[model samples]
Structure formats: structure tokens, C-alpha cells
Target: MAGNHQQLLQLTYIRFVILFCQCCAVAFALLYLRVDLNPWATGLALLLLGLLNLITYARLHSSWPVTQPEFFTQLLADAIIYGFILYQSGGGTNPFIFMLLIPLIITVMTLNNRYIWMMAITVTAIYGSLLVYYVPVVTALSEHQHSLTSLFNFHMLGMWLNFILTVIVITYFIVRINRALQRQQQSLIEEREAKVHHQQVLALGTMAAGTAHELGTPLSTMSVILHEMRTDSTLSDEHREDIDTLQQQVQTCADKLQHMARSVAEEKDSEKTSLATELLDEIIEQWNITRPDVTYSVSIQEDLPPDLRNTTALRQAILNLLNNAADACPKNIEISLRWEPTAIWLTIRDYGAGLSVEQTNTLGQPFISTKGKGLGIGLFLTSTTLAHYDGDVKLYAAQGKGTITEVRLSRRSVHG
Candidate 1:
């Protein structure tokens, strides 16, 4: 009932109309037709149902996220109240006998399959009992009922038409409303995930920047120490060689850190001049260093595509795809680029453990990953970033033994 809480409100309103209809029907029988029965008992029975509806509304208004059990209980009350009313007011002969179908129809639209069965069973059992034990409407009515035979045909026809119309209209509108509610719920979930993703990215960036600042001083100290050791003439040749290698590695690390610092300054400038080929080349070179154990290849047209205005996001998204392919099984991977006037297409195919039919269908859903210990963020973020560029990613099973991931960005995404 987290999602089905609205059922309470709907039932409350329907119950109100039901009470009004019952009271009016009873009053017409008593005043016009001079119907005979225990007026006090019947009035008391109707008042109880009205009170039940009011009590339900009051309780549900102050509370929220009504539970399924609670909803079931309230609906069960409707069945019981109507059953009691049916027994009192000439049961099977009551013109409102068909009204029992209302709760069953509402159950189908609102409740689970099991609850639908429950409503159906409850209403059917109560209605069947009415066939045996209910007072006859003709028996209860006074002798004036015998004189109005001429108008009964038209009156019964009108009532039947009214019932049909009410059932059709309510069922159609309620089903549509339920569908709209479901779509809204899905959108809300996606929006919440997006907010969480933004927070995670920001927090990760802050942490990385802080770590870089902290590591910079130690890397500088190592560079100084290694240089001094290499310069020491008293050191053995092998020791001096190791020191030189250490110094070179430290310098490389420092250069990378410096580039990281300078990237922010160069972002706007790089956007204008960095051709797509050059951008891909830079990413490949960086990936090669990170994953030297795995063999990879790249193929594309001779003429490169143009650079994007904001290149980092697209570049990072591509790298993430490459990383996913590499991680799938690090044997053989291919990156192919295709460009046309309308869009840029980049396909990465890995000759490794591929996805199944089911996995491919739900490829981009957040927190859904096939690999062990995978946080499932990389692809989610890649898809998200590409979405901002009016691009999309598609995953397919390779012809033989791997996965083929394709990315596409419209022409506007790669131009200023």
C-alpha cells in the first residue's frame, strides 16, 4: 500500500455515494411506496456504514503510506457493510444488487492479484447468501406497487442503462489514473537516482583533489632524494642505476600530477583545437599505460571527426566504455570510430565474456552490473553523461564470443 494508499481515499468517496444512494432508495420505498420493515434497524445499519467511511477518512488523512493489510481490511468492511445492507433491504431483489460488482472491479484496478481473488470470493459468497435469505422486495412493498406495472419496464431499463454507464466510466478512468500514477512513480525514482549520482560525483572529485594535494609533497621529496642518491659517486653502479630509474618514475608521476593541475586551465582551449582523432589518441595512450597487460587495437577513417566544445565529459565517457570492455576479459579489444553528418558513432568490441540476452536489455540501469564487486557506477555515469550530449549507448552480444558496445552523439554534441 505504499503505492496503493490512494485506494483508501477512493473507497471513502465511493462509500459516500453508496450511502447516499441507499438512503435515497430506502426513503423512496418508505414514503412513496409505503414499504414495510423495521425502519429503525435499517436506518441504524446505513448509519453504521456512513460512520465507518468517516472514520476511515479521518484516520487515513492524519496518517500516510497505508499498509496493504489495512487497505484490505477497509475494503473487506465495504463488502461486509453492503452484505448486511443487502440482507436488510430485500437482498437479491434490491435494485442495487449489481453494485457488489463495483468493489470487485475496483479491486482489479487497485489491489494485487491475490487481493482481487479475495474481493471476488468475498462478494460472491455474500451475494449467493442473499439469493436464499433475503426478504422479497415485492413482499415488503404495499399494494400501490401492483398498479405501476406500465412504468416498471421503462424504469428498469433506465436503471440498467445507468448501472452500465457508471461501471464503464469509472472503470475506464480509474485504470487510466492507475497507469499515470505508475509512470509518475518511475520518473520520481529516476530523478532521485540522478540527484544521488550528482552527490557521489562531487564527493569523489573533492576526495581526489584532496588526495592529489596531499601526495604532491611526498612525490617531490622522493624526487629530491633519488636525485641526490644518483649523484653520490660512492654508491655502487647497480644502486646508482636503480636510483636513476626511481628518479625517472618519480618525475613521470610528478609530470602527470602537473598535467592534472594544468588540465583545468587548458579545458576551454582544448575544446576548440582538439580533433576527435587526437582526443581518442590521447585517451588510448592513457588507457594503454593503465592496462599494458591487455592487447588492444583501434581503427577509424583517415579523416577525424571535429572536437566537441566541452570535450572532457565525452572523452571520459568513451574511456569508461573502453575500461568496461577491458575489464570484461582482458584478452583482445577493438575500438572503431565512425562519423557521419548527423552523428558520431564509436563502437568498442571486446573478444571476452559477453552479456546474455537479459543483461543486454537492462544494460544501463543504475546499480545493475554483471561483474563481481562492481560498483555499477561507471556505465551509469557514462550513460548519464552521454544523455547530456543527446547521445546514447547500446550493448549487443558479439557475433561469436564477446560484447559490442556502441556510442552515438548527434552532430550538435561535437560542435560549439
Candidate 2:
């Protein structure tokens, strides 16, 4: 609808230009060149065209959008007006007779195939009629005593003006149409990429759920076996310690599975909010349990917002980042938390070897990781999950010192 209105508006503006030029041409011919022509007929044609353009301009501003038929009608009116002027002047011999082609070109570009053929046939028929029915210019030229050389010169001049006008019209409108097409193509490409990304995330989620479900029975069996093994009195102290560690690892796995289930079930109702500092503290504390050996420091701003969100998805995203950082460099990691009125910001700096340009280029894509033993989907999952909250994550190299990960989340994610 908007496109139709816009095209109509463009057509109206072009008509205004054409009308102004036609009036100037008529005045120039009668006053300066003293060419004998029907003054009342030419003037009436111009006045009618001016009125049509005025109405078109007013219609463009109205609540109702311009329809294709209305646009075609306006173009047809323009052709009829131009045809009258052409018939009065010199018929097909008039240089401006080709001006009818302008409306046809506009119609072809903006309208459909049906309208295009209609306008084409209309212009063709008008040209054919003018060839046989138009008034001859010989009487007007003989009365004005124009020499043959001067007549040829005037014809050449009119043809030159027609050529310039044609170039300007075609270049301007065609370039604009080309740019609109390019923008539309770009938008479609971006939309397609987003859909593909969502499909990937969906597939990953389905696989993860299936894997967790399948592992439950084995993990339970391991837990029971380890418990019985630990009860044996003949077991050496070292062996008993190993069994205890294995049992604890199994329990952690079970806990993670349970947490995943709860997070999935409660995703829709996760409107719980917390202070920025509190959420960071909880995430860090939970992270430390899995990576007790990794050292990290935190610096949170005192003026951070209190209504920052504390969703399981957000926690998991942050945890994934921290785990990635730990895997990169186990020691001397830095975590910073801050916020503004509209957003919360978290920055994690890992004091390891900085990422290479190639590694950073593909950081957030699935199955592309900086770590040698990494599954590579952690950052991809982190990115996709944060996107749900209108959040974004960026990774930057810290001047060969380490990699810095910055996360920003909109405050609206919590307020809801």
C-alpha cells in the first residue's frame, strides 16, 4: 500500500515537471519564435494538465492510498494532453511527440505487466493517429517566413532538448528503482540468515535434550555402583578417594541435568529480577564450584541498577563465557559488572594469549572455537540465548594480553 502511494506521488511530481516544461515551450514558441499555432487549444491543454496535476498532488495527501488503476488513469490523461499539443503543433514531426514515451516508461517500471502493455498500446495508438490526423506545420512555418535552414535548426534544437530530458528522467527514476531493489534484497538476505540461525539453535536444543534424557539412566547406574563400591572395607584409601571423586562428578552431572530441565520448564515464567551485583555474585559462586582452580576477580559498580534480570538463560550464557575464559587461561581472570538506566553491562577479561584475527572472526559461529578441545557451540549458544533478552555479546582481543568478552542486556528483559 505504501509503495503504491509512493509511486503515485513520484508520478505526480514528474507530471508537474512535464507540465511546467510544456507551458514554457508553448510560451517560448508563441512569444519569442513567433510560431503560428492555436493559442487557445494549447493553453487549454496545459491548463487541463495543470489541474490534473493539482488534483493528483491533493489526492496523494489523502487517507486513501493511490490504486494502480488511478495511477494508470493519470498517465492516460497525461498522454491525451500531450497528444492534443502534438496534433496542434506538427503531429509526428514535433520533436516533443516522443515525450509520450516518458509516461510509458514510468508505467512499465512502477506498474505490473498488464498496465505496462496498456500504456504501451495507448502511446503507440496515439503516435499512429498523430501521423495521419495532426495539423501540418507547413502553413504555420510559411506564414512566419521561416527559411528551410532555420526550420531544420529549430528541429535539431527541439530534438536536443528532448534527448536531454529523456536522459535525466531515465537516469533519475531508474537509479532510484535500482537502489530500492538493492535495499530489499539486503533485507531479505538478513531475514533468511536469521531464520537459519534460529533453526540451528532449535536443532541444538533438541539434540541436547535428547542427550540428557539418554544419559540419565547411565548416570544413575554409575551413582549406585560407586556408592556400593565405596562401602567395601577391602578398598585402599587412595581407591576410596578416587571413587568418592567420581561419585561427586556423577552427582554434579545429575544436578546439571535437573537444572536444565527446570530452566526449560520455567523459561516462560522467568520474570524474576535481581540487583546487578547480586546476580553477578550468584553466577560467580555457581561457576566456582565447577572450576575451583581457576582464579578470577570481580569489580562491580555501586550505582548499578537493582532491577537487572536474573534468568537461568542469562546465567548460563555468562557461565559459558567464564568457562571459555577459564579454558583459555586458568589464572588471573577479571570480571566487571556495571549498569545504566536502560541496560546492564558485564565485561570478562581473561589474561591469556590474545585471540588471533582468524579465531575472532568466527567466534560466535557454531562449531568454531578458540580452544583446541572445545565443542565450539558454547559461544554460539551464549549468543543465541542472550539474543532472547535483547542482549548482545562481543569478544575483543586485549592488545595481545588476553581476550575480553563484553555482554550487554536491555533492562526491559527484567521489567517484564
Candidate 3:
């Protein structure tokens, strides 16, 4: 709809230029060139067109939108008006008769195939009629050397001018309109991709919730068996230690499932808010508890703002990226936080084997992963979740070796 309106606006602009040039050419022919032409008929047509153009410009600002058919009617009106102008100014013999082609060229470029054919037929009919019936041009020199040779020479000059003007009109208007269409096409493609990504994320969330529910009963049975085994005095000391470790692992899994359930509920209700600095600290602390073997450094600027909407999804997104970095090189990682008035930047670097060109290109896609046994959903889910928060992730090859993950959060999304 907006595109149609914009095209209408462009039409108005083209009409204004054509009208101005037509009036100027007519004035020059009458006063300077001493061409004998009927001013009353041509003057009335130009005046009406100018007044109509003003009304059209005013109508564009109203609540009503310009439909495609209405636009076609406008171009049709232009062809008819130019037809009248040509009839009074010597029709096909007039040097400016080629002005009729303006409306036709503009229509072909901006309108649909149906309108293009309509404009083509209208302009062709008008020009053909003028060839058979039109006012004969009479100049002051017509009584002198106005022989057939002189008239032919004059027509050849007019043809040259016509060619130049046609080239200018096509180059100026058609090229710009084509570029705008390409940009619009690209925007639509991006929108469709985003819609598909959201649908995929929704499906994954539903499946994860169902899987978490199914794991609960088995985890409970394992917990009960582990307790019974712990109390058995017949077990060796070394075996007891192993049982304790296995019990802790099962308990960790149970706790995570419970946390996932709570996070799901909370996300549905409303996301909780926290200070920006404190939220970053909490996410890092949580990641550290899960991946205790990885060591990381943190540096946050002191000029950071206070309140930030920290959803569970956002926390998990950061955690997923951190885990990706840790898996790359668990022994050494660098984390930093910086902020501007309208954005927050978080950078995480790891001293691991850097990504290959193919991996870098397809990193966030589903089933594409850097780790040998990675599920590949982690980065994709992280990227999809961050989009809801008005944030995005970028990865680059670090100075020597490893990948640098940069997460950018919009200040408006964080504060609100």
C-alpha cells in the first residue's frame, strides 16, 4: 500500500516537470520564434493541468490512499491533456509533440502490465490521430525560404531533440524506480526468513517442554536407588565415592529441569528486571557453576546504566554463547562489557582453534556446529531468542587464534 502511494507521489512530480517544460516551450515558440499558434486552446489546457496537479498534490496528504486504478486514470488524463496540447500546437509537426511519450515511458516503468498496455494504446492513438488531423504550423519565414527542403531540415532537427529528451526521461526515472523495487524485494525476503525462524523456535520450545516432563520420572527413580545404595554398609569405600558423584550428577539434572519449568512460567507471565551490571555478573556466575573447568576474565565499564529487563531467555542466550566459547577452549576465555547511550556491547573471546570459513558462514544455522558432538541448536536458539530482546550476535576471528563473539543489546529493549 505504501509502495503504491509512493509511486503516485512520483507520478505527480513527473507531471509537474512535464507541465513546466511544456509551458516554457509554448511561450518560447510564440514570443521569440514568432510561431503562429492558437494560445487560447493550449493556455486553457495548461491552466487546467496546473490546477489539477495542485489538487492532486493536496489529495496525497489526506487519509485516503491512491489505488492502482486511480493511478492509471491519472496517467490516462495526462495522455489526453497532452493530446489537446499537441492538437493546438501543430500536432505531429510540433517539435514538442514527442512530450506525449513521457507519460507512456513513466507508465511502462512504474505501473503493471495491464496499465502499460493501456498507456501504450492511448499514446499511440493520440499520435496517429495527430498525424492525420492537426493544425498546420505557420511561421514568419513561411512566405520566404519555407520550401520542402527547409521544412525537411527543420523536422530532422526536431527528431534529434526528441531522441535526446527520450533518453533523458528513461535514464532518470526508470533507473531510480528499478533500484527502489530491488530494495523492497530484499526487505520482503528478510521478513519471510524471520517469520520462518520464529516458527522453528516455537516448535523447539514445545518439544523441549515435553522432553523435560518425560525425563522427570526416570530421574526420580534414579535418585531413590542412589539413596538406597549410599546406606549400604557392604559397599567398598571407593565404590561409595563413585556413587556419591553419580548421585550429584543426577541431582544437578533434576535441579536444571525444575529451573527450566520455573523459567518457562515466568517468561509467560512477565520477564523480571534487574540492574545491567548485576545481570551480567549473575549470568557469568551461573555459567561458571556449570562449566567449572573453564577459566574466564571479565571487564565491565563503570559507566553502565542501572535498570535492565533480563529475561530467562536472554540469560540463556548469553550462557549458550559462553558455553560455545568454553567448548572451543575451556582453559582460557576473555569477557568484557561496554555501553553507549543507546546500546550495550558484550564481547567474549576464547583462545581455541579458530573457525573455518565454512563454519563461520553457517554458524548460527540449525544443525551447524563447531564442536564434534554439538547438537547445533544452541547457537540457533540463542540467536532467535536474542532477536526478541532487540539484540543480535556477531562472531569474528580473534587476533591470533579463536573466535570473538560480540553480543549487542538495544538500550530501549534492556531498559523497558
Candidate 4:
């Protein structure tokens, strides 16, 4: 993000230079044409504009906040100054009236549509007012100087036509370019999400393999104890039955551990299942074990339709939210899951320190986290997963209160 800002600033500086150069070029052209304006006044205005452009360029190069409102405020000021120069040189009769399109073009490219429209309206008003005030002055000056009335009228008409045509062309291309850029940005975001998901899968597989390896010894010892108890000759019939039951229970646990290990081993090689209930359950159980001090409660709606229940990504996203809630409020974390006709909703409520307005706004953005030791991947990944399935995650918080994170998935049920 910082790099992107730097790039934008660089581009802005280049634009400033380009505008300055264009102003200089226009001034030179006017001098060559021997316009009626004072050469000294035009030269002075051009010099002032060039100096302002340099200042803008220097400021953008500095480490100051590029998005600061003041930055754009100054840019608007510079644009107005340039417009005034054009007005002074020829007013409505000036061939340079079409140059007013430059600032409007820059505004459209750099700002939101609403801001662009506001600027357009403002420029139009300014231009119209200038024309109204300058038309009679220009006409009087031309007549006093014995200038040809027909030629002056023709020039004025040409300038108006040029201004109209330039505005139409600039607006059309700017909107088209903005839409194309938006699509490219969306594509880049999707690609980054895919990479992050793949990375997470690799990390989970590694953790699972390590956990399975670590649990092997304890399961083996339990198995040996059960074997010894079953073979003891001194055991009574009732005792033997109890021992048999104990052995079966131990065997079941061992089978589960082995299955987990196999699953981890096959994670990279095997295809993923559409239904992720087992995976979700395992994740919850693991979190329960890891944070035994935390009281965690999860309620999945029993009537969840097949379509909603079958989405692996949605399950993982819900699990991530649950885990984040548990981590936030270790002593009292509650998660509830429900299904509606159009969506599946998972809410994780925590009694920990609530987020501020700023944090809430940037909740799922990368590197924006509230926890001290948190890598901040949990919520980001969950948000990304939800987005992939045409879903959303929302965080609500109040002052001195807790946070409620709601994950909403599009599919309502797995029944379909």
C-alpha cells in the first residue's frame, strides 16, 4: 500500500510537470501569434505557474501524507490559477478557453465520480461567468482597435465549439479508462486472494502433520496398557468385560489419530471434499484443546440446507471467525450459527476490548489487526473466503463493549 501511494505521488508529480510544460507551450504560442495581451503580464503569469508546479512536485516527493486533504486543496488552487491565466490572456474570445478541460480531466481521473461531477459543474459555472463578464470587454477592445468584426465573431464561435468538443471527448475517455482500471484492480485482488488461500492450506497441512506425529507416542502407550489388561489371567469376567470396553475406546481414539495423520498426508495429493462438517468439527475440537481456559460454545443450525452445509470455504470462514472470537475473549466466547433462505450466518461474539471506529472500517484489510501478537491473517482470510463465495463479513462494536463479527454466506442450506 505504501508503494502504491508512492507510485501515485510520482504520477501526480509527472502530471504537474506536464501541465506546467503545456502552459509554457501555450504562452509561447500566444506570443508567436502576437495576441493583444501584454507580453509582460503573460510572461509573469507563466513564471508563477511554473514555480507553483515545481512546489507541488517537491511536496509530492517528500514523505508527507499524499492523501491529505490539503494536498488536493492546493491542486485545486493551482488549477484555478491556471484557468485565471487563460481568462486573462483571451477571456471568452481567447483561443485558450479550451484549456479549461485540463483541470476537469485531472479531477475525473484522480477523484471519485461525485467529486468529478462537482468539479465539472464548478468549472462550467466559472467559465460561463467569465464569458459573460469578458465578452463585452473583448468586443469593445476589438472595435476600438479597428479589428474586423466578422473575424472576431468567427473566432469566438470557433473557441466555443472547440471547448464543447474537447469536454465531450475528455469525459468519454476518462470514464472508459476509469472502468477499465477498476476491473483490473478487481482481478488483481482476486489473484492475491487465491495465493493467500493456497498458503494457508500449506500451513494447515504442516501443522496437522506435526500434531499427528506428536500424538503418536501417547496413543501407542494407551494401546499397550489396554493389551496388557485384556491378557491378564487374574481378571474376573466382569473385569474382563470392562477391560474390553476400555480397549475398544482406546482403539477408537487411536483410529481417529491415524485418520487425522492420513488426512494430513493426503491433503496435498487428494481432492478436497465438498462437505466440510468433519473438518469444521476437528478445528473446533483442536481450538478447544489448545485454549482449555476459554469457554467456547458453537451452535450450528440443525436445519441448514445441503447447499449451505456443503460449502468448504464457508465452513472454514466460520471456523476462522469462531477461533478469532475465542482468542479475543478466552474466558467467555460464544458463537452461534443460523441459516436463512438466502444465506448462512455465523456470529462470533466476544467480551474483549472492542474495536474503534477506525479499526472497524478497516477490519479485514491485510496487516490491520487489534491483537498485539496476532499476525492478523485469521480475519483477513475469513473475509477473503466469504468474498469468494459471494458473501460478506461485518464487525460491530460499541464503546467500552465487545465485538460481534458476523459472517454471511450466500448459500442458505446444503439440502439442494
Best lDDT among the predictions, by candidate number? 2
lDDT of each: 0.77, 0.85, 0.84, 0.64
Looking at model 1, which ten-residue stretch has the lowest summed lDDT? 137-146
- The sequence of per-residue lDDT tens digits that candidate 4 reaches over residues 1-416 is 33334434543554555455546545544444334555565567667766776676677667766562454465466557656666665566566576666667766566567667766887787688677665222333443433587657656765675566556555655665566567668878988977886777567557757877888788789889878888889989999898888888878877887765675466445534343345456567766665677786767767633344434445456767766776677767777767676776767788988888888887776656788888766787777667766788999993466888877767633332
For residue 323, model 1's alpha carbon misses the true position, in angstroms, by: 4.2
Please give each candidate's TM-score: 0.55, 0.77, 0.89, 0.42
- Clashes per candidate, residues 3 or more apart or on different chains: 0, 0, 0, 11
- Two-way lDDT contest, 2 vs 4, winner: 2
Error of 4 at 330 (Å): 7.5
* TM-score (C-alpha, index-matched) for candidate 2: 0.77
Q: By descending TM-score, how would the candidates be arranged? A: 3, 2, 1, 4
User: Where is model 3 poorest over a 10-residue stretch in terms of lDDT?
Assistant: 142-151
Better of 1 and 3 by lDDT: 3
lDDT of 1 by residue, 1-416 (tens): 44555667777877887788778777876776665655787888899999998898898777567887788888788788888887887787666778777777777777689999999999999999998997655523336544566347534853685487468647764876587568768978989987887876777568768988998999989988887777788999889888888888888888887887787577676665466677788888878888887787788877757665446667778888988998987776888887888887889999888899888877776678878888766787798778877889989998889999998877786564
RMSD, candidate 2, Å: 4.4
**Which has the better TM-score: candidate 3, or candidate 4?**
3
**Residue 64, candidate 3: C-alpha displacement in angstroms:** 4.6
